[model samples]
Target chain A: MRVLIMAKEGEKSEAATPPTPEAMAEYQKFNEELVKAGVVLEAGRLYPSSQSKRVQFNGKKRTVIDGPFTETKELVAGYWLWQVRSIDEALEWLKRAPYDGGTFEVREVIEFEGM
Target chain B: MHRAIEAIWRIESARLIAGLARVVGDIGTAEELAQDALVAALEQWPTEGVPERAGAWLMGTAKHRAFDLIRRRKTLDHKHEEIGRSVERAQESVDLDAAIDEEVGDDLLGLIFMACHPVLSKDARVALTLRVLGGLTTEEIARAFLVPVSTISQRIVRAKRTLAEAHVRFEVPGGAERIARLSSVLEVIYLIFNEGYSATAGHDWIRPALCEEALRLGRILAELAPAEPEIHGVVALMEIQASRLVARVGPSGEPVLLLDQDRARWDRLLIRRGLKALERAERLGGALGPYALQAAIAACHARATTASETDWPRIVALYDAVAQLAPSPIVELNRAVAVGMAFGPAAGLELVDALVAEPSLKSYHLLPAVRGDLLRKLGRSEEAGDEFERAASLTENVRERELLERRAAECAAQGTAG
Candidate 1:
């Protein structure tokens, strides 16, 4: 099964500061462990909601909204696309992440069924 | 509830067994303990929510079971005292968190090497590896391979017995021994992938689950042996090959040729992963191994936005290197196909013709198939039709045979048109 693990922004914003080399290294170490277990398919940290855009559609009329939206709690800071056997397995792997008390949600992707 | 329990077991069984094996010396007993843990989980988990650390929970249960078994054996035999001491030592080593992780990693590697030991037959190795490392049930394996569940069970049962009788050490060999054994592990992994990628005799043309299992196993192997370029190479090859799996077959399950496949249908994530793996293999290179070389060749096709844009000459060069290393008729045949694409149909047909008298190529359906393709390209439709007919007659797969016969009829029509 494939799952998307979304890392929610903590109380301190993800865009607040650049990552230190040590912090990056720690994350890399944790990622290596996941890679060793062969569950990680892809992972990336987004550039924050400030650098993003939103498009709204109403009866074929489109409206563009600028970034720096008020709903910061709904924003995802980073995510990983994982191929794990089960959601519980994904949770077990997530618990080992080096994140500093970050809230994360794991959602399964509905893959197209085929023979 | 049972399905969820089984899924958790599938995910955790290998590690659970590995942890148990660290305490109990024998794999057979370790597996039994692990199964006991699984049964306990099935009975308890729904009432008590699933454990936060399901694997560790399973490991703890299995370890307790191991202790009970060791205690029972100690009363019967004096040798259990040594095993008891080892278990104590193992328990002590788990004091540090890093030590626990390190032990699990080593134990998993030990399990892999033990399952794929060269002492077992090829079929036995595949069966045992799937059972132990891939965490697959006998029934699942049997269904995937189109064999009776009894056959798979017997293979695993016998494989375990063979390992016990041979006294195969349950640790990854070091130095030159590690390198030699690594190839056997890789061969079995690839064999499993190929069986799924191109089914030799199954009704379904592609079995994605097996391919996924192989890729998972290969990636895990690559992680353990990061310095081994061949590990990354095989991973790269499997990734690239699997990238096209969806595009490699039609909606109705007919095989699709590489050039004919819809490039847009290929899995871009897998291709990216494949390219990354290939890059790693190249960076760690001395000389390119057979798998690395083949991966490089596959990358050529993968990098091409369209079939017409493929770097055929480069592929031909890579195939030459492969031929130099392997020195097999199969390699030569592949090279001939590359030569045809790079140069011309006449040149490819010339190479294919030389292999006509080869003893190894005599019964190979691909020889006639390649000959037919080249002949068709050269506009010798009548000869091409005959070749395709011969190819169709030799193939066992109903779909492949139908494809070959369709090509023959097309060639015949083209011949009559002339």
Candidate 2:
């Protein structure tokens, strides 16, 4: 099963604070395990929502919204596309992911025909 | 009638199971449904004079079985309505011909990936691939590998359960994941072909059935991933190698060295196909990958009318490129052989001697076998005889051992004559 694991932005987050060198090393180790296991299909961190943009389609009218929107808590900090055997297995792997403090939402990707 | 049904089932089973797995979301259940369809075909087809489109007929039957299975499952109460609605929709809209034509390719690719998933052990992967993708019976797989039927069956059953419990998806990954998965798929196919090309432990020198099956899988993979140059490269390598199969073994089933084989016995059709595939790989651009480079080397041999006409320098160059890309002791060893062919026995012996102390090749029979050949060429008959004897002792295949022993005897005869 393919899953999207989104690391939600923490409430106390400063803008785009990178992990410590030791923490970065731990994350690298975790990434290596995922790669070795052939579970991680794709993964990447997002810039602070401050650098993001959203376009809304209200019927025919279009509206452009820039990042640094007030809903900082709901912003995604990073995400991973993992092909695990199950959601439980994805969660087990996620438990080992190096993170300071951030909630992750695991959602199964709805595969389409011929995908 | 039973034989006809078995033959049709062998051809259609992999796609049937793969398509069913896409719908049912479980390979185990999909295979069961496919089996049920096969049973239906056995009972109905003989009486009904066989359907015009046998594959579609089997797939349609299997899909219906899947629907029935879902309806019969008591524990899936929450999913019953949702699955029922989709199943009903599928039954209404599914055009058997269209499904067979459009979905089979992707479905088979997905099946290949799932069978070779990294979670399973290599033995399990081989057993599962032969069982599922190659459409071989457990008994057949066992016979090919020289293992007990029960062992192959057990490996297959456990492999399926592991995939089920782990929930391995029925989809091919994209990007870097696709490349990684492709390598495993290619490796499994290569292992199968290698076993067939040179039986590691069996009395027979080659198992043609395994080679055919592996070649079939490689061809199918090339079709599915036409854009992937490595897929074509692998197919090219296997095809060129398979072209020589008829001439690879003696009339009494002894191993025939490449140079000693009757060139007229080589399959020209397969050689042409291999060269075409190699062209496709080369057209894709960039420096030749390991498989492609190997295919190029094989092509040089294929182009040669006789042993003396072989472009050894070109082969040596290709091997040098392969060694640079892969950089393994095995690749280096192969390079030494090419170097010997291009240069002389002394040069090849120097390269082979350099690897004698390399720990990885310590027990590898070919290291000594190559050394024996170079020694014989250099007229060091005593040393050559000893090396061939050592190689014979180390080899597992009865035919190879015999061949090595014969070479040793010939070397001793030369020493006495000189």
Every candidate's lDDT:
0.85, 0.81
Per-prediction share of native contacts kept: 0.39, 0.00
Candidate achieving the largest lDDT: 1
TM-score of model 1 vs. true structure: 0.91
* Per-residue lDDT over B311-335 for candidate 2, one digit per residue giving the tens place of the 0 to 100 score: 9989888888887888898988888
Candidate topping TM-score: 1
In model 2, which regions exceed 4 Å deviation?
A: A1-115, B71-100, B200-206
lDDT of 1 by residue, A1-115 (tens): 7899988866544476877899889999989878888999999988867777899999989999878777666788888999887787786677767777657889998754452
Worst lDDT run of 10 residues, candidate 1 chain B, spans B199-208
lDDT of 1 at B114: 83
Identify the runs in model 1 with alpha carbons over 4 angstroms from their true place.
A10-15, A18-30, A57-62, A95-105, A110-112, B1-8, B44-51, B71-75, B79-98, B200-206
CAPRI rating of model 2: incorrect
DockQ of 1: 0.40
Q: Residue A85 in candidate 2 has what lDDT?
A: 41
